[model samples]
Target: MLRGSAETEAKLRFQQASGPIMAKGVEDTAFYTYQRFIACNEVGGDPDRFGVSVDSFHAYNAHKQLEWPVAMLATSTHDTKRSEDVRARLAVLSEMPDAWTRAVQRWSEMSQTYRKPSVDRSIEYHIYQNLVGAWPIDAERLQRYLEKAMREAKVFSSWTRVDEAYESAVQDFGKGLLTDQRFTADLSAFVDSINRAGEENALAQKLLALTSPGVPDIYQGTETYDYSLTDPDNRRPVDHAAHAALLDEAAKADRKTILNRWNSGLPKLWLVVQALRTRQEFPECFDDRATYEPLPSHGERLITFVRGSKASKKRVLVIATRLRRSGVTDTVVALPEGEWRDALGQRAKVQGTVKLDGLCAGLPVALLTSS
Candidate 1:
């Protein structure tokens, strides 16, 4: 910056110089080496902190609403280590650490035959976590990702001094393990066990990203259950036709239909459409002047909040389960007095204090506004 008299030109030069340095050093090196709770190891994220408290979350949102309300509120970006849905799915492990540990141990023993001398436990561990996150990924994709990952870690192999033998063994391990029916079935069963809670986590994550204070940032293919990886992988083609078809389907579908198809990614698409329309319809509620009011929920399992006020004549109430609940508990939240309707356009009215489960119906999330 000091080299050139033109400040703008000098700053650009410095930015260009620093960007690659940061990417090569931190994004490439540190991200690979530090594998403790890898879900938190995303671009612009703290690797140590697994999750945040509702109070802290609310405080951050309130601060944004009061300060930089227009900053992009991103759950997933091209720069992320893993996609949002992938992270959401992986987060279920936090709830069942013992199960996860036992599964990892079993997986390692099952695949011990495939490991070469250079293929270390650390890389194998990383592979297992990533497999759960991006389950149902093809063998080719899995092998490709493994090569990239192992190389990035620079343990047994690296991009510069490529460990061809070790990389080959890792690839063979991926292919072999994938083909091994018993191992695949075991992994699949474990994933299926946590799948429901993962879906709930994904839904909650979706709503929070959309309704949080700041301009909501929607990444490509993220309107659905995107189990994507880092760049080039995340930037892969999205099916706009399918998205449009889902939107058309959502237009005529009833609330029951909306709540039934979490697996189809229709619910996620419905959420995006409704949340965006709400922003467009009620600009005042999301503007810099809008108020952020945190509401209290019974049992505190739900992170409840209202944006905007009566003075604005419109407000958005957002609700999402804070923890994974197996069956709906008798949770309740106090509501603003008026005829409340689903912002997702479900034909239902709510008033006064309402049971949380009844308010959300079958869904783990609720988006409402009042007339």
Candidate 2:
């Protein structure tokens, strides 16, 4: 069975790489073929399966107004090169181009002291400096960060065969950065800026993708902020215990207010789960046949779309905000007259047009679903 399976996989890979004729002839033909075979053979579906490219999926969503129900949209994967947090932070750079450029220039200037070193040495120094400078330093946080860095360093050192000197330097740098309070604050600010930018970008992408025509798939642990660097970090075990503790604390206290005021990420996870549950319950409303009418907002921060069956008498309008830095209050959302529910807050009312000032209020995503 193993031999046969291997042979089948090899054949499928060959077919996939042969030419566009075999891979792109039909919508997801290549992928479906592999999935069907895996199912028949009782093999678990490949996590690395090439279901569809992001570009192709987005294009399909744009073109097919009636086919939203069948398509799935996703952003992150175990095989992805960067962590979602990193991507989100990077996305902020696009919004604050000058800030990003300035930050990079600062990093470059700081790194100039070691520029003449060999490639391996330079990379080692840079990684060490980044880890040391960026790690948060509360006792518990420091321990966690150190353990993660040490584990990753071991893996990286082994994989890259970095010289003993470089490894020692990285370790020493980390130790110094951890012990020195002065450097910690400066480094923390820089790291925080990168993280904030990344989070903003990620949130924007999520809001846009979720409200778009296709079904959005949430990767594990993406609901809250994830700041891992590469594969193992991205795939780190979900800390259910910590999450439970957080939930317990929230239940005992006014967690929502704290989260909202501090921009704490706990609410984002809730929002994602709620959105998914809502989407699942109202699958008919998001069927591929539904039209996608993008509403114009005064700023790029707002994105609105309406989805409904052409044959059905009812339609659902979804308005989401991509704003991260600014607060929106009593903002008006224009929709065809009827009643609507605030999917994020469960606030409901009847009206053709509604005001949504504090609804989005720094939240990464907000949904207004009409019945």
Candidate 3:
């Protein structure tokens, strides 16, 4: 071969051999993806956004209506870093940074002994937080989860170039965490403490996704509490029987009973069923050219909007909340003058501007339809 051809071929071979290094190059992609707000790092989402404000959210939806009109509004996907519930729990940290900082410090100290000497403290700290948020509370499940998490994190080890020594250390850490009763107890208590707020955030997100100006989707078994981690764990077999039973129960449930099941995440299912039923019954209300009027709310924590069709003269009012455990007392959303009835339940007429405190009493969301 010519001298130049020999050198070029050598370089090409070197590049081919360096494929593993090329793969490792994207390891920091996780950091670049979620450095702003970890919540937006999910598949198909812009990771640079810190968080979506109510106005920005409405604006985005409006733009979509004008442009795409059929965009997917989703909370969780198969490849999400953490499940939607975990992201919801993490979002709560924004409201309580002090509490989160303190909790992280306490959990790190509590689980310090479980960390392998070879493991970095920073990575260990992150692992504990994610585990607390998405932990399945099962030894085997958590073990598989930690292994995958540590590998994907690529801090101490990676899939392309496995560091058996470090990987073994991580496995050892997981085993120790499971065996240590004190560690397990503290972790469970911490998770339980944050889980209630997580539930609230989850419900609020569900309501927003379903009522927004796009087609809402419900992943399999998501109607119930899906506190899954990621991948195969998130892809666990769903109990359709139980879901069918819950749907049956939700169908028979009165508004009050359904509201009481909000914590169980059944109310979200109920909201989905009711909203889709309305959309199916009156497809014209969801037309791209239909009017979308965002109702003015008294507080930043509440988002209210109305969907309507001038041609068909149909309207649907949606009210959903945000933040953790926020009260709706004294908060009001302005509406078009008409008779709007709670489509999810009783047909009590709502007229003019309505006070959310009375309307959304003990409910995570409200769906009102025009008569």
Worst 10 contiguous positions by lDDT, candidate 3:
27-36
Which one wins on lDDT?
1
Q: What would the per-residue lDDT of candidate 3 be over residues 12-47, giving only the tens digit for each residue?
A: 888887875644444334632234345555655555
What order do candidates take by lDDT, descending? 1, 3, 2
The residue pairs that clash in candidate 3, if any, are: none
Model 3 CA deviation exceeding 4 Å by range: 1-37, 46-48
In order, what lDDT does every prediction score?
0.82, 0.52, 0.71
How many residue pairs clash per model?
0, 16, 0
Q: In the order shown, what is each candidate's alpha-carbon RMSD?
A: 2.8, 9.9, 5.7
Supply candidate 1's per-residue lDDT for 288.
Answer: 79
The global Cα lDDT (0 to 1) of model 2 is: 0.52
| C-alpha TM-score for every candidate | 0.91, 0.63, 0.85
What does candidate 1 score on TM? 0.91
Segments of candidate 1 deviating more than 4 angstroms = 1-20, 297-300, 309-311, 326-328, 345-347
